[model samples]
Target: MISLQSGELFDTTIKDLLIPADKVAHVQLGNNLEHALLVLTKTGYTAVPVLDPHFTLHGLISSTHILDSILGLERIEFERLETMKVEEVMNTNIPRLNLNDQVMTGLNLVIDHPFVCVENDEAVFEGIFTRRAVLKQLDRRIKNK
Candidate 1:
């Protein structure tokens, strides 16, 4: 049987819970909108962060954004997605966290957002703390008790 020591759960940090970016599904930076949409369709994630060559976070793209773009047009431009850049439609306003931040801090942000982008002190992207991951921990603790 597995055992979690006392205070172990409470002491957890975002870093301890985050699933590294590479491990999670993602879309590459500068990829075409069609490719990004394909990624989202295949991965089934509502959104994915766009990362540069050095893995610095550029922006996030979501199905809603893509749909909105199509909706804004008088007529659906299916081919436009093929030529559009992800950077052009991606949302630049995103929340972020440092691994050193307490889990509660990360949790609060994630409660309002789908995930919290993790970064180093220098603002280099690292990974993400997803809401599903936090809920999984809660589920485990509840079951253990």
Candidate 2:
């Protein structure tokens, strides 16, 4: 069994477990709200990180947020949604982690959020620490043992 008697493996660096940004489908800050809805619909992802052209993590956009905004707008015109940008409705308070932070720093975050955004030392968005991905890694270790 891949047992860490003292739970020491949680100390593993997140860099070793992260779902690299390139492997994920992210939304751009300037992307239209309609585009956000489409991505969530197509990907079936509850939320997706919003990045700038330089891949800086700005916020997270979710289907719920898009739906809420549309309902609040009370407008049926698709053009309205097209005119609004992801930055306008994306959640800016989502949790963040350093690209090299220990996995322990991400465990608590995964308990609540679907994923935690990771950034490099330059504060550039690097990837996501997804709950499923983390669990999968742990499971793989156990199985291999």
User: Tens digit of lDDT per residue, candidate 1, span 50-126?
Assistant: 88888888778998888776664477878878888888889989998887887778878987998978987877778
User: Which stretches of candidate 2 lie above 4 Å from their native place?
Assistant: 1-8, 72-77
Question: How do all models score by TM-score?
Answer: 0.88, 0.88
- Against the true structure, whose lDDT is highest? 2
Candidate 2, poorest ten consecutive residues by summed lDDT: 1-10
The reply for model 1, stretches above 4 Å from the true place, is: 1-10
Q: In angstroms, how far off is 99's CA in candidate 1?
A: 1.3
lDDT of each: 0.81, 0.84
